[model samples]
Target: MQETAVNVLHPLKTAALAAMLVLATGWSAVAATPPDQLLVGMNMNNVLTLDPASATGNDVVPVAANLYDYVVELDLHDPTQVRPGIAESWSIADDRRSIVFRIRSGVKFHLGNPLTAEDVAWSLARTLKINRALASPWKAYGFSAANVERSIEATDASTLTIHLPRPTDPRLVLYTLATSIGAVVLDRKTVLAHEHNGDHGAQWLTTHSAGSGAYALARWRPEDVMLLTRFDGYWRGPAKLRAVVLRHIPESQSLRLMIDRNDLDVAMGMSAPDLNALRHDPNVAVETVASGSMYYVALSMSDPKFADRRVREAIRNLIDYDGINRTIMPNYGVFHQRPVQSALPASLPDPGYALNVAAARKLLAEAGFPDGFKTTIRVLADPPFMNIATSLQSTLAQAGIQAEVLSGTGNQVYGAMRNRDFQIVVGRGGGGMEPDPYSNLRALVYNPDNAASAKLTNFQGWRTSFSDPQINRLIERAERERDGAEQIRLYQQVQQRYDADVGPIFPISQMTNTVVLAKDVHGYFVSPAWTTRLRDVYKQR
Candidate 1:
């Protein structure tokens, strides 16, 4: 790959630029900003709204995390370890039917209201009220619209208790709380103040935030920029950086240019080519960590040919996993077909599907498409997936299956997937919010309640209308199983069954997401869930 010009953030650049501006104009210019600021570049289009209840993509996780606090949170460095947030300590009942938290005292929302148990209860209620987006995962935990008021209660000023509708493991309850939007606390007084027509301020929250986090929202102009300022009164000390500015630049080369010129601090959401070109630049430190998401080709089982089990197996064999991982996804992806990410337990190894054109052709003939047929694939207009989709198109053609690739933003692509509007599509999405098997198993495979009311989540199974009553029974049994050993055994059984019958073609797990930053910046690591925290991050300057 050709090398790119990448440089560290120059401490004197602000002054130098200011001097030039002063020289150009007759009047004096504003003083240069202090070096204690961070500018992040990413595809901010995924963040259409900041309402934690409605946040759908991990693309906005880092941003939302800065402005909100969860009752319990996943340890950023290690998701398996649950950590405290607004709630300093928590305890579960002996019967495993209720959990109570001791809300941290003196923690103030950005609006100046001190943290209270009511805020904690109201936050979860808000997501339940919205009945969409991040609220979808709660249904698996026994949360439903009808049980909202009865299930959640603020017992005291600093005590919040939740009663489960069904018996569940305490770990499962904490796991859900650690999600990006799951246990997020909202200011009850502030949100209620903006309520109109029983909307619970869902409309107002789309553009504003009312939380007690390290940083607070300043302004957000969709598709342009989101500006945030440090909250000095944060319960967990103030942020090291004074401000965080997120710029929306879809072009990878443009982001690289900004990094090269020291105009940007960190550049995320860049393509593989742009990142590969910066690998050797001394001033640019690229941090890549394996993520919890998978890249796969989802087939609409509604298609008569795809409905055949033989055809689905043959399509799996047609993928060039080794070739794609070695050449196309170096430093960014790993071959993984198991529904769950390897970091989590019960995730099985690849079932050994090699690229065999003849075998695929035979399977195609068995499915009644002897000579193959034409189809279309929807894909995000970004790297790796788009490039991989093109490769798939080539491989499928060899088996006499002609395919056309359509490119668009994630909303356009995934929207089609959710609507079940396409025959096939190269997509990337899965549950990685917590370090557990069910988050992925339930979202990608189990769909016993796959109905219009359950569309709150983008469970791929719903799109294909795939469900197995046996698998659903196992999933619930596993959730209710309290014994650690027994729980693992049950989840592994769920994985085994899913691999044998599921129609989606999960080819690889994204190995690492690259976040390029100036070498002097510290405390930014690749996220397990594609998210980062700015509280500990600081510039050498």
Candidate 2:
């Protein structure tokens, strides 16, 4: 909920508050935090890049979430819906292209500069300009380096306006803005001052932070540790915790041991068995929540023989969802078919695609594979991905299809799929972390453009050259629909239409993030994106 001022605070009022604070605490800014703070365990080895424009991994999302604020944000209570953040209020025009945002007055960066429309415009321009690997998620929304500078502009200091080339679904724009990349509003003065030889202060940002948020980046040493201190002038108020320490203890056993000894407050990144054991410990609490991410088995449409519609339907029928959900994913996952989770709007029913060996065999026979055929599917090097692959192999063997499971690192597996060097593969990814269903569908299933222009690295449908003229039209229509209810109806129609064709991918589960923390710790939701800012957490004391 927003707490509005009667009007902008007068300069004298701000000065009086500061004077009162100094008189009461003998400090000008804030009281010093106690030495002991909340410690959170997470992996930071992959966090080399600090520029939000170039950030594309889970490693940097949590870091940026605390270090910056976007124009709008997703509500903590209902993440799929929109909430106001830095921009206290905003409005859209009748033409639908012009979006006017009013900056929250009196907000200051951690480095002591007021946030303004200039900073918001500059940061967005930077993201579009650096549109490389980092801009992958928004690429589907038709945003590109070629057009962003002309589209997003600041009308004045307090009024920032964005002009789209065409009507973009309002929720799509808002939800997209709520993400890490869209929220990277830096301190214009501080960042510009640190600019070295046109680096846009990227070199400095890798080690220092210049933004306004609940926490400030205190220290960052690659592969070691990252610490965040509560912002002395945080707009909301002081954070509950004194500080948040993300220690890079690589081993799950080391994390477990440290938390058990009270040297740490959380033990993250552990395997299911480790968590299962920890759940029984009197001092530990394991919590699991459904996430937007999904795992699926996708077939390569480039394989002409496998192109038969019957083959696709048969593969969907052959998957033993019950077997996998019960044995392999007790705490890690839940059955899911739609690209988006049920938590979001317009999620279609499961379509009741279940295990039916007889039906699968019948389809295979119709497709001239009565005797069954051998095929190969790729999976990540991890045990879970491999376990799911092996299980599928056994089930497929029942229908006379001899399947081989190739294992390797995620890059290796996804690379093979992207390169079209594999027949089929089991993969996990969904909105990168945003729960926006349009974003997920665009990346996973929509491919109106040809493979060359598809930027198919993350587009699973394009990875297999799976395309449909009808699906593309429906996607475009849904992207421009103004009414939310109409948009949901269009999306549901798209989902059912694609399912009717037995789309190249068969979704098996919606990933459930399972985290284990100390019993006395009160932490916020561990989002589907697998990143959470620790400002809302505290120790019971």
Candidate 3:
């Protein structure tokens, strides 16, 4: 409940040496010297928001993950599985309305303070108050300020019980933990200490961190770098890496050069071309994994010009996804996966918007615009999306639809999407190991309130009503079903609806996060949670 104790200058020289022996001779025959250090690189600097409860941007998620610990841990080996982190094991009541967890004993925060039941209660409460800005997954779990307290109680320092409003499915709990938003726990006092700045824990978390994880934040200077040191007193065990340094390099060229020059161990946010080129090099071992994320061109359904189904369809048909796939994401496989799967209620069916000039022309004529109309498209200035946007701009020209490409950062594009300022724009949506399409759809398409809060849903401006009752019911059903099979079925049902509808947006492939590691490093776990479990990882001979 209180902030974890912070101990400085603790040495693990003896333990590290022992670990080296176990790694080399104990398990194998030939013993070799381990590399002294490991280096990693990322495109942008951390969001400078370290509070596990309040941080958002992907840039911060990785680092925050390193510094924080969660009670309900997700099983990366099995996306649907939920494992205990702070808690040792848990049980669900026969009625399924209450779940109880037996907290793991002997656990201490990075600050050296012991973890307790009170802390668990405080962390959950903090999540509810922070809501979407801090952790959308908290809301997804159906947790509310009132419902939380009435349902949650700490039986003891090592025990916690949660009572739900009604007997709901256990699957919801499982999915919720599958997200970083839910997995990120907070230090009660540290979070509460910032209550005056705002109700949310964002203000306090930005500068301070007191988690019970394997690493501690030694220094975090926004725009410059973030430095992390292994927490020797970690409950699980001492981390293998002595330190982690993350530097911000916004320019793709600079990042690539650095990686190629061996100045960096990892480079994130590279374009497909550059990534593909790296894959071919013998010295650079490149690998990609599926990320449950998607990039798409969202058109404002609220706009008068785009309000008509035919007009929306005409514009959709004009999109050349294949052309962009060929020119821009060449290394990426065809048949891009949507950010949201078809199963979610908010999903739109592809508008059958392929590269059919004749069909686009016909649809335009039927929409009473015999001459193709012109529209401006806002896009992120970054590569891949920007390049794809330009390709779209050129493709639309074929259909006599004049398209102007406007470039900006994520914030600017997001702002435009919420306001419906531009006719269309390109953006990405992801996060959550098993996102269950609704995560993407509800946030982007269905929620009317989302249209106003660019902060809530970037594609919320669209008032388009999709007539798919089956999917609508399934969405509700999936949310309640505790059985994995039933949820999967419900997901399939929604996906079918999406295939039939052919909405404006399309699916891109799920991306696997790729990172380079020094040869000395061993035992690293790369999770869909997008965070590295550096505790057991270590340098080897």
Candidate 4:
């Protein structure tokens, strides 16, 4: 099959075309997107790097899913269930200290190199050696550069074994393997050939790909466009589409207009207003799925004001959860006040926290701030963050507290939070991509260290300088609990304790991702873990 390059119109050119069409024909032009190709539109600001070991944001999940393959995959409808991928099957050791995988035969990488167990072993070992952002989960599970070589190994061409260095639920390790981008198997030979200095191909893999997946990297221009061509020798059948082109069109209005005119097939990251407007259109279909993440308001406990439990409770009371979910979060998120995503059986129901100005004032008075105090709220300049910050500003004023909204890019807002420099922040994050309570707790609540020099930036609890021995004990105990029922109970207890202790991070809502697709598109189901695959997506006309 011959590969085709799909032309993506520049945003300005698209607007000019619309204006010309309106003036000439009294209507906009409806250009049919190519039947053999898929065009996606979304904001690419967060897609800073494509190297799986370093990629840290949701924007890179779907891209990496199509470019590489994992040993196992989480079921689309039920993430708790694991499905076989590169590894045909795997078995846990009798003592639950190791897992052995049986690598499949005849799998070929995009570069035509044969896939082997050595590739799987090297890929995971490299992830630890690099020790970047994506290595957090592995490090949490006691895997490190010093022990990774001995802990993970290929016994033969078709067999790989991974030994655990600590006591923890083996299932959590499997879940991490199934969902984490770092676990994607790389073509070791191809990658090492491109290695520069002692970087181990870290620099080359940023803009390139060497995997046994449905698509191969064709061209990538950060903040502009990415093109992927179908890999004919993919272990699975070749992708239905000849090529997939992802365009970076940050403006929601432009995406709305393009999809309306049939110039684009799929649009993501659209504003709620545009999604609501497209709901009644017959040619377009608006779909939503529960994303395993939360929208939260975090406070830095290092600040003397927030260190007081009474003041922390007062700030939590000032949030208008119901109003925000009902109005501002219509298409953005749903009301959820717990750290864990609501889909998990281990998760508890919302604790019914509403805007209580009177209660907030009383708590403030008890905390010796009868007149309230002034603070700044750091938030992303995007849709829901800014909107949530504005709502918080209004409610806080009612409680006599003055707050200024500080808006910036993801790096600006999150960087300040990571450095323990922000007073308050309206952000959306928690490692709920995997369907496990521990994933959420480890990211939001489990802080093993509280010292400034520890720099556990990956853990939100550490970032906020909030640590409780009781909460930490519960999280650790829950992870090691072998009894299913007891594990659930422990997770529930952690949430209850967090509420009573007035933890700094307060979850306001659970995220629900919405996408606008042309009606003719089929087999485009969104993954709750953000690993949406495009191998089977095709256009009818």
Model 3 residue runs over 4 Å out of place are 1-36, 166-168, 190-201, 330-334, 337-353, 430-432, 435-438, 448-470, 482-486
Q: Write the per-residue lDDT of candidate 3 for residues 54-89, one digit (tens) a residue.
A: 666666766766787777766656544677788788
List residue ranges in candidate 4 displaced over 4 A: 1-30
**TM-score between candidate 1 and the true structure:** 0.90
TM-score of each: 0.90, 0.87, 0.84, 0.94
Error of 1 at 374 (Å): 2.3
lDDT of each: 0.76, 0.74, 0.62, 0.87
All candidates in order of TM-score, best leading: 4, 1, 2, 3
Candidate 1 lDDT (Cα, 0 to 1): 0.76
lDDT of 3: 0.62
lDDT of 4 by residue, 470-497 (tens): 9999999998898899999999999999
Error of 4 at 485 (Å): 0.4
Kindly report which residue stretches of model 2 are placed more than 4 angstroms away from their true locations once superposed: 1-35, 192-208, 529-531
Q: Which candidate comes out best when scored by lDDT?
A: 4
Error of 1 at 183 (Å): 2.8
How many clashes does each candidate structure show, in the order listed? 1, 0, 26, 0
TM-score leader: 4
Selected candidate, larger lDDT, 2 vs 3: 2
